[model samples]
Target: MVGVETSQHVQLSYEPAGVGDRVLAYLLDGFFMGVYFFVVFWIWGYWYSLGSDPADLSLSWVFYVVIVLPLMLYHLVSEVLWKGYSPGKKIVGIRVVKVDGSRADLSGYLIRWLFRLVEISMTSGVIAFVAVIMNGKGQRLGDMVGKTCVIKERKKAKLEDTLFKDVSEGYEPVFPQVTELNDKDIRVIQDVLDARSHYEYDTWFKMLKRTRQKLEARLGVQDHGMRTDVFLETIIKDYNAIHGSVK
Candidate 1:
């Protein structure tokens, strides 16, 4: 298990898929790719056989353009559309995530796909396996360049884990400056609140202190005899009341 520290300083435990699991996923993908290529190439061959001279076929380039190009782009396209989960990764119950616990974006997916050739294809996955084991982050060369890691998707904690309290409709917010933070910021805070059990009390203390300080500085308000935990809890409720849930 690798401990990933989210942007809010929350420690989330991730089970990095081992080299064997990765290899299995790759093989599954390869099987699909192979079957696709076989069927495509057979059709192409039949098309070619109809022409006496290969050069006479005006659509010969279609084979490369339609089949080869898509084959090469399979990983990139799948990951981007599926939000870091290719069919194989999804089946393996693993997905790519940013180190900071944010969703992996298009650029990150592209980086990983670009390096897939050398990491998995060229070296026959030896390099990727070795790198993943050594790095302990379930990362191949692509993941390193992309600044992402593959982790088993487990049951994530719900909003209830944050222990949000109910607020009356007429209740006034403590900090209007909570607007300075966005949905992502609130999510980070929620993740921090949810993941308290994963860290020591001292670590949680420092995290709460740091979060409180940042919020205070941003709001231009000094502490007004509010405990750190209470302050944070109120901030969450205020943000939710002011903006609904984080989108």
Candidate 2:
């Protein structure tokens, strides 16, 4: 397990995916690619099947643009669109992340994708397997160069561990409706809140909006132009005030 300190200084632990799991994910991704190839071949003609030297100009150009280019960019496109999860990685419950539990930038993703040609395609994954096993952090050559690692998506900390704190003296509660949230709900809110700084702006905004909508529906309260992050922060403080540790 790797320990990461969030921007808030909260300690979070993530288990690195094993080499075996990564290999399985790779194979699964290959299977997805094979499916894609079969579909493209079926839709277009089997021009590249076995010694077919036909000269159909438009068909050939269409195939090259539709099939070849996308095939070449598949891994890169998938990771970016899904935020570090290829379809296979999403199914396997693992994802790419920076060492410090932050979202990796586009350059990092590109580096990893570029290295895939040598690490997996050229070497048949031998180099990647060895590197991932030798390093305890589940990093292949791509991950090392990209400064990222694959980690299991399971969160380690339980709600009981940090659900309540000592409410400061002279604190006024903003929303009595916060008590409508149970401990589990509080934990989910806290998790999203703590994780906000780790994501880039767009992702964080979407997440905040979703969480805020859900809370507003349940609590019968609207933000009324209040910032959503502040709404959640105030919820946590109000919860602490209601059911906090003894002073």
Candidate 3:
């Protein structure tokens, strides 16, 4: 388990996939891509053989443009559309995300895709393996440039970790303003809540207070006559109830 510290100073745990896993995924991706190109090339070859002059085969520009271009673009397109999982990464149960625990944006994804030519393709992955080993974060050159790391996908232990709560009937959300917070904000709130009982009183209070202040600022609410812990819990319950209904 590696700790990825976010910009907000919250540390999240994720298991970084090993070099072996990455290599296996790469081989799988290569096999699939190879099969695709082989079929396309075979079709084109047969068509040209039947009618076109044999001399035309020397140009072969069509194959490069049609097959190679899309192959090179594959990583860029896949990561962008699938939110950081190429077909290989998806198969291996790994995904790329920003170090801050937020989603990787388009430019970040593009940077990783571009660096793949040097780190993986051009070097046959020697450079990638060395970098991943040294970085301790499962980062290839692409990941470094993109500010992202690949993490293994696994089932979380606690229900609260995923932020699903059971709100009772007749629940009136004290603050509809809770909607102003996004998933990352709520995740940090939940993390604080879940960790509070484990820490000393003063330590817990400090974290709780910070969380409360942040939420209060975002929601523009204050001094609701509820205990600090209760206020935070209520906000979470209210958010789940409101968002659940919308879903």
Candidate 4:
């Protein structure tokens, strides 16, 4: 629900994950941890029961190192390895990012993980729920301290703000014939592209067929083995690359 602007302040590029998504992801993570702790405890308890043996008696510290340490570090290590995605977050299609819409660094994840001990483990997520609901940006105590927020990627993004679509860097323009499209023609193309999400597959395919035919006739471009959607986006990028701004 929170908006982060896209390229050149054109429109909101990313949507913040809703509280429901956050809670579900949190529960999934907690469940995973619960399973993990149970397994580790069962194995460790069996090992510790062997403490009557002198060989096992000397390694009492092993329990703390193997079980407790990893339990404590689970979230930190998972987020670090997965680049802001714990197993649960990945399944929920959400990720943690810096507030400015960039990926968080190791230090950022560490800060958030540190706060997890208090908000989640100690108070049982009461604090985290309150903080996330009170704040409009979907930030928990950890996120606020780490300058990070969770965002969901499951929903389709709205690209209606401006005609200037953000092209990935180092994109090579394939169809030079895209230059034949005037502003109005390009606008029609953009309209078709944006409208695809609103229609079912059959209707959208028909629209794509008509648009592609029109573009091919006007610009004399072929499919080049690209899908209908791919061809359309390429020309839009080509238009951007060849012609700088929308205006």
Candidate 2 lDDT over residue span 1-247, tens digit each: 5657544334445778998778888888999988999898765565545545556535667777888888888889998889888988988888888876567678888998999999988999898889999989988888888898889887556544557656778787888888788877776667777765566777667677778888889889974567988887778778988877444
Ranking by lDDT: 3, 2, 1, 4
Per-candidate TM equals: 0.65, 0.62, 0.66, 0.61
Kindly report the root-mean-square deviation of model 3 from the true structure over all alpha carbons: 5.2
Backbone clash count for every predicted candidate, in the order shown: 0, 0, 0, 0
Better of 2 and 4 by lDDT: 2
lDDT of each: 0.77, 0.79, 0.79, 0.76
Worst 10 residues of 2 by lDDT: 5-14
- For residues 1-247, what per-residue lDDT tens digits would candidate 3 score against the true structure? 4455554565446678888888888888888889889998898789887898767665668657779888999888988899978899899888788865567899889898889999988999899999999998889888888898887876456654457677777888879998887767766777777765456778778777777876787788977888888888888888887877321
Q: Write candidate 1's Cα lDDT for 135-234 as tens digits.
A: 9888878888898888888765565444344567787788887888877777767666655676788887777778888778877879468988888787
Off by over 4 Å in 3: 1-15, 105-107, 153-164, 167-188, 191-206, 215-231, 234-247
Model 4, global lDDT: 0.76
Model 2 regions more than 4 Å off: 46-54, 57-60, 155-247
Ranking by TM-score: 3, 1, 2, 4
Q: Which model is ahead, 1 or 3, in terms of TM-score?
A: 3
